[model samples]
Target: MGQHLTIVDHPLVKHKLTLMRKVDTSTASFRQLLREISLLLAYEVTRDLELTSVTIQTPLQPMEAPILEGKKLALVSILRAGNGLLDGILELIPAARVGFVGMYRDPETLQPVEYYSKLPNLLEERMTIVVDPMLATGNSSVAAIDLVKKKGAKNIIFLCLLAAPEGVARMKEAHPDVPIVTAALDECLNDHGYIVPGLGDAGDRIFGTK
Candidate 1:
């Protein structure tokens, strides 16, 4: 994964992830855990955001306060599963501009097929964070990032709850510049393109579907 991938090894994050992995975990619990974990991941993902100072008056006196520079960042959810992580991160960064890119994998080829995309304007002016719960084959993520970049997004980051080695390699080959943040980098992907030891189908678990 090199420097492009960062694993959030916080104990709280891992504990919640464990609960989420259990097959018996309820939908409400899974949803809540995902939201909490995303907030922790969000903290790490935005660790390097550029900050500028602003003068502010406190009870003590006037002081220089650090504030994020430039326009609010954009959060692009790779829908269905992405929305799970999105709901959580949104709580941490409610001021961020929201967008969505809807895509699905072809069961046979395991390739991404885009059906919808509604991104925020002025991508060139804001940092874009692409969110998805799982990164398995990574085809969807690569395709989504390609769209974001073409729309003039210069600064980009890929955030997910779990990442597979195959997916990490795919992203590195396609977008070496963009960094990836995840709760864990699991073992290799299964033959069907699902991450092993993964929390089953994140979309299904989150939405309480079969």
Candidate 2:
């Protein structure tokens, strides 16, 4: 809804996402699809990263080319499902530092409770990207952002494979300064709070659980 949310509609992204959404897709295929889609999403998400000129020798001659500048990136994975997307983004930016945030919902309250969290040094100085496979209710996502903010990260980017409108709205309301990037925005959340017509439980699908 806000200008910060970038829903990537690239054809290749759409194609890969469709495959990942199929009911019959295997764990192997699902993992591969997540990796591929993550790469595509990372490409779009990092478009505005600062660049600096560097001297290099080209095949034809010596030249000064622009390369990524400023503080190194810090990727914060929202545990399990987020790890799938994290792998591919790390492949692209190997120099980027890695962090993890794990939260599990309480069975009765259905509220997110943190289990684990760790971050890189100078977090406030680096561009931080948080990856989560699905943004269903947005509670976990918001809580994750809260944790990161506590660590003093100002420039934060949230990346997910799929999102629901409710989750998006919730995120914007909670953290207007953070931008979200996702492959698809689905219809609505079902009674159980799962994204309807959504690829069933992303964590389960990625790990081949029921």
Error of 2 at 105 (Å): 1.8
The global Cα lDDT (0 to 1) of model 1 is 0.94
Q: Give a tens-digit lDDT track for model 1, residues 1-210.
A: 247999998999999999999989999999999999999999999998999999999999999999999999999999889999998888999999999999999999999999999999999999899999999999999999999999999999999999999999999999999999999999989889999999899999999998
Q: Identify the candidate with maximal lDDT.
A: 1
- Decoy 1 TM-score against native: 0.97
- Please give the TM-score that candidate 2 achieves against the real structure: 0.95
Model 2, span 1-210: residue lDDT tens: 247689999999999999988999999999999999999999988988989999999999999999988889999999878999999999999999999999976756667899999988888999999999899889999999999999999989999999999999999999999999999999999878888888998999988877
Give the poorly placed runs of model 1, Cα more than 4 Å off: none
